[model samples]
Target: MENESVLIRYIKTKKGLLTVSGILATISTVVQFIPFYCIYKIIELLMLGNYSAEGLIHWSLVSMGSVLVGVVLLYASSMCSHVAAFDILYDIRMDLLQHLSKVSMGYFSQKSSGQLMKIIDQCVEKMESFIAHQIPDIVSALIFPLIYVGLMLMIDWRLGLVSLVPLFLAVAIYALLMGKTMKNNKVKQYHDALEAMNSNGVEYVRAMPAVKIFGLSVGNFKRFHQSIKDYRSLVMEWSNGFRSGYVLFTTLITSVVLFVMPFGAFLISQNPQDKTLSLTVMLFIILASGTTGPFMKLMYAASTFSNVNEGVKRVDEIFAEAPVKEQDNVTAFSGNRISFEEVSFSYIPGSPVLKKVSFELKPNTMNALVGPSGGGKSTIAQLLLRFYEPTEGTIKIGATDIRETTIDTLMQNVSFVFQDVTLFNDSIEENIRMGNRIASIEDIRRVAKMARCDEFIQELPNGYQTKIGEQGVFLSKGEAQRVSIARALLKNSPILVLDEATAYADAENEVYIQQAIGELVKGKTVLIIAHRLWTIQHVDQILVCDKGEIQATGTHEELLAGNPLYQKLWAINEETKEWEVK
Candidate 1:
């Protein structure tokens, strides 16, 4: 009941439809039993020598009519349940996505795409089966046996008690099966194996290009190979663990007649002249056999319930994650002067990425952060965008603390171009329009020309309408970077953060990208995580960071002469300038 509480909220939305389905299923169960009762009436009439053509026809027609009505009601019940199931599935998926959008990027960093995909796609889908088929089926399955068994008891106490014996044994064996499964943690193991397999399979597909180029075999990919092996082992173990109990339950359920028939025959043999006793025994035999099917169906529903319960629990876990909180009264910034005062952070608890670091970028100034690869330069940029919150201290824009402002306001003011450019599998125009949704086609083209990607875009088969990763219209790394810049330019935010915008560009592309950035930072507060020191030499301020701390702040020449660490980095950079491929 506790596990089902989480799912109940989602179910409540379509409770009316579910209720109708259940009611219809109940009626169908009662109507289905009428056929068996009508058969008994016809047999009694014949044995008592009270048969007539009209009576025989009436009973036979009643039996067939009952079956038809039952079928119609069952069909209507199924239709209602199916409609509710699909609508609920849609609502669950939409809610999941909405909740995910509120959580921090750090949550995504800790989870894989495959793991999330399994929860979003497969786990939520399991609820559809339970709602559509199992819900209605369970209603009928539970009611059918109760209705007939009660009727049997009203007719004769001895046969009714005897009929229940096999059912009780079947229920006991099923309970034992469930207990063994839970005790062994079968449900958890089953989901874990599936998540592992899905994760590995997605990785294998993504790495297929590299695999083919390197002539790699399945055996060489240990993670994927081991996932398959683990799944096989788990399936074998799960099947074997329940095999005996399942067989016993099935055998007991289907052989209900075997138990009741012998006792019924003994009663009839003891009272041979009593025609009523003989007819009662025959009726018990007919009804007891019918009860087995409902019990079988119930066992199936119970098994599906366990799996779906596990799946819904996994979905609930995603919803349980805390989202980034927002202030009730947000403070608007007065200016774009970005400041970080003693802002410390760590991706992991004890290993710090940025430690008591502080910096400032004055309004409309181009500032540069130059450091070694893992020296917290990029972390500083991410912190400004609130991809993560600092462990201590404050980041402010003018007189306003960043935490006091809404995320939408902060995002609208800042435009970021990542070191690794991301372009969707969409048209060139649509991809650039992501920055400013209301930007005109001319606006997009103007920025594209400024970023120097206009010529290649025009040369494509469909021009700006060409789709990426389709029709052989893929952009090179440098071309993609230019498109990314065009997007940021279109945004035209008051503050800009560039994390190595030209890191992967060729010399020609670098020249064009620099021209684009020259236009983008005209009236904005800019922060650049620079790799090539020469590019940012003339910026207003340069901060050299080392080992998660800002070691020095100065102009290019001042740092080169006064800081030993800066001098060493400069020497290394200069040496790399002369290196050439053999």
Candidate 2:
């Protein structure tokens, strides 16, 4: 019953095709039993001494033809199921991708790539076996039993009852194994172990370089090693626990002949009449024993229902996440000024990252936000991008509230160059084109020159067409920073946010990047979040932030003379610059 719910939930969209497949398979199963009936009739005729050579030959041909047709129908049924399964997989993947695209970036931060990949790839793939093969097997297993029982009863009621004894035992054993106390908990534990192992494995692989540098062995990687051990232990425990029940179930289902033969012989001994009828009944029982084979196959297929259930649950959980809301009627802003009015936010309740933060940046001016690492500088920038909404207060662009505008409109008017740069596996030109998809090759080249990306990009084998991989055509951190700057330059938005944009650049790259940033921020309302005090020494205004609050608002010299925290931070930066190897 639980397995039925899982199938129904996922197969909702593909129900029509699955229904057709089930119907065809059921028909095929019924046809498959035709030969068994034919054989029984041939034996009965021979026992009655009414069979001729031609009659025997005709019955043999009929049995052979039934088997052949049954095979063709089974093949056709499988083809339909495969088509439906693959189509369902495609739809599932597409739906997941679309949902993820709309979800908050915080979702990605909370989930590892490995975990998401396992759900999207492995979990979805696991459903293929259930949909393509198991569905048909289940249908045939269910329908075959009813037809088999009826045929057996027609021969002899005593033999029919004997045939069902093993089936009843198998069912009882299966029920005990799948009862609430064991099956649900054990299956849940197994899936949890698998997910943990997948996530830990990905984390370990990603940290391999650091591990090697630190002379770390697999045993030293505590979390990854522990996850692997836990998974192995859980699998072994489940196997050991379920082994006896599984063996008993298999033995009982297949040993139907054992009970049938003994009982048939007992009946014959008691009656001592109609010897031919007795022999025919025993022969029919032998042929009917094969019915348990389909039931055994059904049981094996049913075992995977737990995995399918887990996968569907995970997929549904992803779908349930709320995306950033956008107003249907979007308002247009007339200017580039930005403002935050009493804005506050927290990734978790009772742990505010930004507390009642309020600030405003005038149009076509440079402003800087200087603060410590956890002083909410990055959070402020992300809020403007609508990566998350303020739990309280309002953020606005020009004269209109940001919430009043569509996300697409908000993105179009703002550009960001953060410390972390992510470039796709595509060509350099293609990566730059992401900023403005319709930008021409000439526009791309111009921005590349302006952002100083052309300097190293031109040196590559294919220049702008060069492909990138994790290890392929490696770019220095500074060069990658310049490419990101080129993307921002091509975007040419009215508002620009630079969060440690030049953090990775060396002295030479820093000079080039600053020059490029100068061109990109021209006549734009810009907010710069920097740790290095020297970089923003000449900005139009500086807001000193500490503990999620603005401590002071002044120029570099003003802050140095006015705010002790700012003065101390500046002093530390100055001291670091003068220090050298002794």
Candidate 3:
């Protein structure tokens, strides 16, 4: 089966350990048959009217010893599997995380965090369970039957062949049933349903604030409710479909004596002289019937193979994505000027978001991009960050094409502070230190002061060490933005990109944020995207963009005097500022 192949390939790294486990499991399973053989011998002695207490006690001790040895071997086998399984899990998770770090940010836009979490957490755990527990079960399951059937045939070939007939029939029926289920693609459907539910559940929880504020009902949370309903329906359908086949399989496999007893009795009827031998063979057949229980357990464990295979395939899909290529011979840049030369890009093919956008920022100069909401201003910033490669043209930092250098090299020279500032649930000092890992206490404090965050940070109970969550303290948007600004200032990169950095600042914090920006951008090649027209009025240059094209590019006074679009925007900005509350 495809599932079997997936598991085999995945465990190739741990094949040595798994092989040892398998060998041990097979030995344990073979040892288990010793008690059955001892019982048969004792029964034979009784039938022959040679009852001896010492003989009985000896055989009983032998049987108990075999059982004890088998238990030890089985425990050793499980121990090996457990060690290998945990090691393999660690390797798998580490490899996945490393690959994700190298993958382009564009990959994240198409995949949800919930979906990735399910794959990384749940799917990997499934693989671990399969490797640790199910693998030993499968090994014993497979070897037990062969050894058991061989012993039966060695005793009496007729009853052995008869006993195997029901097993073969049960297997055929099982195959047919599984074939139908596979054809229905139930496994894939189940995986999809679970992923959807995970995604929707995460989304619903994240939207709880809005839900409560609007008094949203279950109907309002349609996507989450629908996913739950759909998952329930699929589970019910799968269980209902398997119900009949499962009953039939269990009955046929477990009832081996039903076939063997009849054939066995018929054989004994023909030979009265060898009555003791015939009766002993029948007892052996009855004892061997116990194997069906282990077989059923094996089948139950094996059924999960499909889910494991599906999980492996999903994990492999993530690993298969091409990472951002780094040039082997590339070196760092020496200048600070940034330029976009006729660059074009599209999130989706055929429909361009940035149409041959061209721009330049001189070193140590302020440049502003003024545009409508969807006018590609953010796309330009994203491209500069190399989150996604441009479909056409080139972007250069200083004299080097950005694609020619490694992402690490490019990122080391530039810093960005966007509108949506995300602060981790950690201490204030730690969050600021993320900008520059090697920054000392004094260095962090210097930037914090520059960003106007030191005053507020000092006011908190733990000062710089205060955690940023419900347990410690919470920050307003403006305060959070200042912290982010502190981070950017600490990095002290030559090139700076500010995407609506002051958008969330209150009127009071705006003055401090402006002063922070003044300190941060003093000697950097700055490219700022702003909606507040008044803020950029004194900038060195402003580019007015509309419909993914630059309509005009000049100083603010030049634009207001000659560009009609700019004039109208400026007028509206002025009007909004002067409007009084009723």
Q: How big is the positional error of residue 197 in model 2, measured in Å on the Cα after superposition?
A: 2.1
Write the residue-wise lDDT of candidate 2 on 22-59 in tens digits. Answer: 98999999998878767877887787787899988888
Candidate 3 all-Cα RMSD: 3.2
Q: After superposition, how far is residue 90 of candidate 3 from its true place, in Å?
A: 2.5
At residue 465, candidate 3 shows an lDDT of 95
Off by over 4 Å in 1: 1-5, 42-57, 271-275, 440-442, 458-474, 506-512
Best by lDDT: 1
Q: List the residue pairs that clash in candidate 1.
A: none
Name the runs in model 3 displaced over 4 angstroms.
1-10, 41-57, 261-275, 278-282, 425-427, 455-474, 508-512, 578-582
lDDT of 3 by residue, 314-335 (tens): 9888878899988987678869
Query: Candidate 3, overall lDDT?
Result: 0.88
Pairs in clash, predicted candidate 3: none
Model 1 lDDT tens row, 137-220: 999999987887788789998889888888888999899899888888898899999998888888888899989999998778
Worst 10 residues of 2 by lDDT: 1-10
Better of 1 and 3 by lDDT: 1
